[model samples]
Target: MDEQSTRFETNAGVVAQIRQLPVGVVLASGPFNYPLNECYTTFIPALITGNTVIVRIPRNGAAPHFPTLELFKKHFPSGSISILSGSGREIMTPLMEDGRIDFLAFIGRSSSANALVKYHPAVHRLHTILQMDAKDCAIVLKDSDVEFAAAQCVTGAFSFNGQRCTALKMIWVHESIAPQFVQKVCEIVDAFKVGMPWEEGVQITPVCESGKPAELKDLLEDAIKHGAHILNAQGGRFSKSLASPTVIGPISQHAKLWTHEQFGPIMPITSFSDLSEPLDWLAQNHFGLQSAVFGYDPQELATVVDTMAFQVGRVNVNAPDKRGPDTLPFGGKKDSGMGVMNAKEAVREFTLETVIATTVNDPRNVKALQGLEGVSRVVKGTAGIKSE
Candidate 1:
């Protein structure tokens, strides 16, 4: 923990937020996609900042009664963290209506987020953070390593059954290199193994959802009707609780795949003649969670990336997109989400700043202002003010 302080003089004395205090009680809701990660991203930091929490988690993602929950019980006093489970917003409704919940950190769909804001106008007062759906995209330049980029996109699109919020939902391949890149992507994705859960030879597993396969199929059919081509070997099946990875290519901009957030193993590939076209299309979309691009144009890429920096939360170059390390702040933009998350961001978001001040002939005579442990950087004036 770093000891941070600010020195300034006023009629009364010097003033600064000596400490970042915990905001208050939090109502944290976990997403069904990344349970372990989303949980820690919200609850842990709030707890660290001295705020109690009420967590409402989706049943499918919750790690049952294990260290995730048990460890919290073992260390913290009772009631510091409480877990509530129920379908949809059944459990969330009453909690949101409760006046005692001081804040909310949620990673879920926009419908739920809308409900939270609508039902609880005071939600903003809680300093809430909501992570909504994302229609993330990947751009492949003509000059890129086509095969390598294809492989990375395959993994980014189908890994985790494409349930990840930051998963590659669409690929905008350069028109000149589109055919070859699609061939490589098709070859790799075609060989991907899909089977029942816990199947040894299967590389792709079932979705966390039970009925999402039908939704994905409907979207796929719509894309095809709208001039999209299917690229996979077409050797897969979809059940009520499971769906095989589906790759559709040469999707038209008019297709639903271009607009909707398909949180399944349905990858849509589009071709663009100009690099800036896809980048601009992504910016125009409602979601701005994260994006990736593969290219060898060092100077152009840098300039493009600099422009993209403020448009999205994070940008991955030649690499697959991820939520990022616990140390680096991660969040969404526009309709995707607001506020930020990360151990460091969490500490800041969960705490409120209050100033401390005092007058002293020698600044060292007053105790140095202490800020959040790790994030603080302070200077000690033990010998008093230095001569200019």
Candidate 2:
């Protein structure tokens, strides 16, 4: 436990000492898209904060971690870190029902997250860090750079086959620039190199999740049935796991694609005559993770930022919605997710702040407490100590 303590006099005669302590046991579960990185984001923090961890290896990406079992055992005490395989319901249900887990770190669907939390015997006592579903949007204004916006949208919507929860699932362009924006997006997506991941310069590759290709096809077909068009040349071409990058546009509000997250290489586009259209859509939407707005006009961009600030966790101005640099806080709002996760926030999330205090007149007690290692003295009576 990296302990930092501060002593300060409160109300002239009383002294208070505060520090952080571990939150007991953490049960972490990551998603298939970023199995190792996502799991470690929680594991490293929980372990460093002196909590025992039990990892539920994702069904799709379980092979990669098998070799690292010895590495964890080598660094940590016996049973400090345990990796479990096989059925999630079989293993995780008993753990949650046992009421031993203090923190739940989950990066997956909201439904699964809800189910897992419900299984816990003490729901109120469980601290959850969830990264769930998102239908993130990108808005392009009339005054924006059409080419740049289109390129960013293509990258944001299709990167990792749009598997990321932060990926832009929908795009809205101003009516005046919709045609140009859609054309540019299609051209860029069509030019992408599609092949195996090991192939050189492959921008799109096979999806890992089973039935993902068919699921994307169903969404595309449903959108088409409801008056949407497949704008790209080779869009909607699916062969087993290899589904080509697709762009379906002028999508109807009634279309399933408007509400459901494809989680694949399908870009859904819409046009708006008034700015209120997108704003109102966002206000009514269930998921609010992030949104991207591209324009040159300061007032127009400011309006977007201000309106979306309340609706989503992040608002990207003239850029694609992404989670990177690992320093900034990342998570979602509404049904998208519950808690924030990052370098600093992760540590704070898995730990608890505790205080030890005594009267200043008790010199023996103060001396004994201050003598402890890792204690920092902050005099002149401040109530709280900022985390380092």
Candidate 3:
């Protein structure tokens, strides 16, 4: 068996604690985007905690996580782990309704989560860890180093084909440096080789072939229709791949891309006169997965750290758009996630708590009598006063 499929030997102490808890079968479900890594994150943790699991792999309009299923069968005991295929209804509904599944761990849409809560209310054992959606932002202060800032923004907004939830969908740039930053970012993105995933250092890959590009095209058209300008459009079509790394300039709130999770290679740049506007927008948004702040000013840096409006799982300080410091929790506020999930956090999520107390004697024990000394003194004083 592969290292991930086996029990996590390193977390033996934590595993011992979890084993003491009452855990039953769990249902793990999510899209099949990054099969090996994503499924490993959920399935391995669930199984290691002594909870048998039913893993529902994403369809992805393809083969439905065959590779991951094979891995599960190879490593897990019979009935300890089972694989389910198909969309949510055909697979998840029955699995969730089953009385055996004590909990459900999911990474999908908010609507789906609502339905689970409504239909399976009696599954009090239900525990959900979701990575719903996000309009993740990158705030660039005027003090940022211009060239380095451009490189970071380009990588964040475009890498992994903009498929990651942490990807920088919208960029908030101070007006003073907006023009130069936009030009430089566009230059870097334009020079990127958009090709097959196997190509040498290819930065951008296809999102989907059928109609995803048209959907993105419509979104861009809508932005332009409502007064947003395209800053960079230098990209080539490689067969059916959606490889274009399109970036827009200074989009208004009215634009759809500004308020939604693009989930593709579409970067919208929004200029901020001050941090207040972006903070206002962040507060009102439903999703809060991650945000990147680029600044050198100590005051501005402290403001980002202290701001309640930007409440999220992880906040990057002038770093690349990526998950950080494995020890840190990876989740979000309002709609990004239900609970934390990772390392020690993951084990805790799939566990139960029980407390046991043992005492040698009853309430009349010597220690208990000593505890009543203060009250006894008050009673004696009251009696003596009455007698006097």
lDDT of each model, Cα atoms only?
A: 0.78, 0.86, 0.72
Judged by TM-score relative to the true structure, which candidate is superior, 1 or 2? 2
lDDT of 3 at 346: 80
Best by TM-score: 2
| Residue 270 Cα positional deviation in candidate 3, in Å, after optimal superposition | 1.3
Tens digits of per-residue lDDT, candidate 3, 158-224, equal 8788877778988889999999999898889888887777899888777753667777777888898
Tens-digit lDDT track of model 1 for 1-388: 2244333334434433345677888989887777776766778888887899988877886665356667778899998889877675788777777767788888888888888766664755767888888888888888899999999998899888888898999999989998898888888877887786678878777776667888888888888899877787752357677777778867877888888999988889889987678878877889888889899898868866886677779999998888767788899888888899887777788887665455454544443432232344423322243211
After superposition, which runs of candidate 2 have C-alpha atoms over 4 Å from their true positions? Answer: 1-12, 367-388
* Model 3: worst 10 consecutive residues (lDDT sum): 379-388
Clashes (candidate 3): 0
Off by over 4 Å in 1: 5-12, 15-17, 358-388
State how far residue 291 of model 1 sits from its true place (Å): 0.8
Residue 314 of model 3: what lDDT?
A: 76
Looking at candidate 1, what is the lDDT of residue 315?
A: 92
Tens digit per residue, CA lDDT, model 2, 126-241: 99888889999999999999999999999999999889988899999999999999999999999999998899999999999778998899999999999999999989898989
What lDDT does candidate 3 reach at residue 235? 39
Candidate 1 weakest lDDT stretch, 10 residues: 379-388
Over 4 Å off, model 3: 1-20, 61-71, 121-125, 235-243, 308-310, 362-388
Worst 10 residues of 2 by lDDT: 379-388
